[model samples]
Target: MERHATSAELKARAKGQLLGKYGTIIPAILIVEIIMFAITSVITLPLDTQTMPGLIISFIIECLLQLFAGIFIAGQTYLYLNISCGGNIRVSDVFYGFTHHPDKAILIQLYQLLLMLASFVPLFLLLALWMVIDSLYMLIPITIAFCFGLVASVIISLMYSQSYFVMLDFPDFSAVQCLRFSRKIMKGSKARRFYLDVSFIPLYLLGFLTCCIGLLFVIPYMNTTYSNFYLELMSKRNGGNVQ
Candidate 1:
């Protein structure tokens, strides 16, 4: 089996693509953050969050926000993909998901969310049992369940990390098909993906050291690199021919 590009190579490609583009990328990232902040602020303004009903409404709102965020993320992915490929892209392109097959985007996100929840079901069940039995022995099983759930959730997430990219590449495919294809291509490559992610920790830490202002730059660089990773993975799978 062939290996993908090293993390340094991918990041270098991302950096090269990002050169002179911060003028567009930074503002786009800010727009996304502002929009999310404004939506949360406006929606929760009238509600007394301390009350039970208000709390429930808040939870529902959070869930809806997550659903909407999925679409936004697809749009972001589209923008990054274009940037990485040197295609024409506008800051407004960040909203592409809303106009382009939003249903599929939402469905993909919902499916992933459900899978994550399902992964934790065992942990939930064991915790519930421990609550009822009130035995010290139950702690061992609960701990084991928690560990298993965490590992499963992480695996599932990594497996489907490329779903949005797949969706963009194959617009005709259904959400489930996109997910299945992502998992297929991701086989034996999750560690590569995970390592690539870990490699960004220093940049994230640097962003934090800058009072988060640097994250505006880091976010797009990281996203574009991940986009490159997806492209490289696809290129490898297709005999070095990236569509």
Candidate 2:
């Protein structure tokens, strides 16, 4: 039987991996993620969307950029994981993902993004319905439904969170196959993964408090921990002893 590692174990292992190379590791991760942060900041800034055409054009551009970012980052995450597992580390390692099976990469990320967006559709629908109906009584139910949708989305998203790692590690797998493999491997461990993520929230909050300077360390640690977790799971699956 394959053994599953807890979040604590994975984080410790990853931290040990980075002990002698913080200077190199941290900056490499930042190089990959910086573009993502910049694009997101631009997307969120107050846009003059008073006109329909302006809104549509802006939305289209943002969507395309986001899609491009997602694909490249999926590759970068693979890069980081490989490095964490003792592959050659370089600042340019972030760009190495561009040569991966990119078409499948885009497909998987696009589907996941679309599915997440679909999850919010109910919230919007309920909000619109509440505005049209002038009843305090109906407002209560709409709000309840919206809350349920949000929770469901969280669960759904977490369940397949390992798909990116799978897609890269198993290049022969299609996007849907990668997703299915993630779902299978993650069985009964979604909450554990969620717990792993939640444990880092405080560190992230503290990092933000440091004028975002601390994120230079925090983000790489977080990303490495996640990648290590995937690696341990993969090792166990292969019946090899996890290091």
In terms of lDDT, the best-performing candidate is 1
Error of 2 at 226 (Å): 1.1
Q: Which stretches of candidate 1 lie over 4 Å from their true place?
A: 44-58, 130-139
- Clashing residue pairs in all predictions, respectively, total 0, 0
Looking at model 2, which ten-residue stretch has the lowest summed lDDT? 234-243
* Per-residue lDDT over 77-183 for candidate 2, one digit per residue giving the tens place of the 0 to 100 score: 86567757787676766665577777777777777778767877877787777788867887777777778878877887787888888887788999899889998
C-alpha RMSD of candidate 2:
2.9
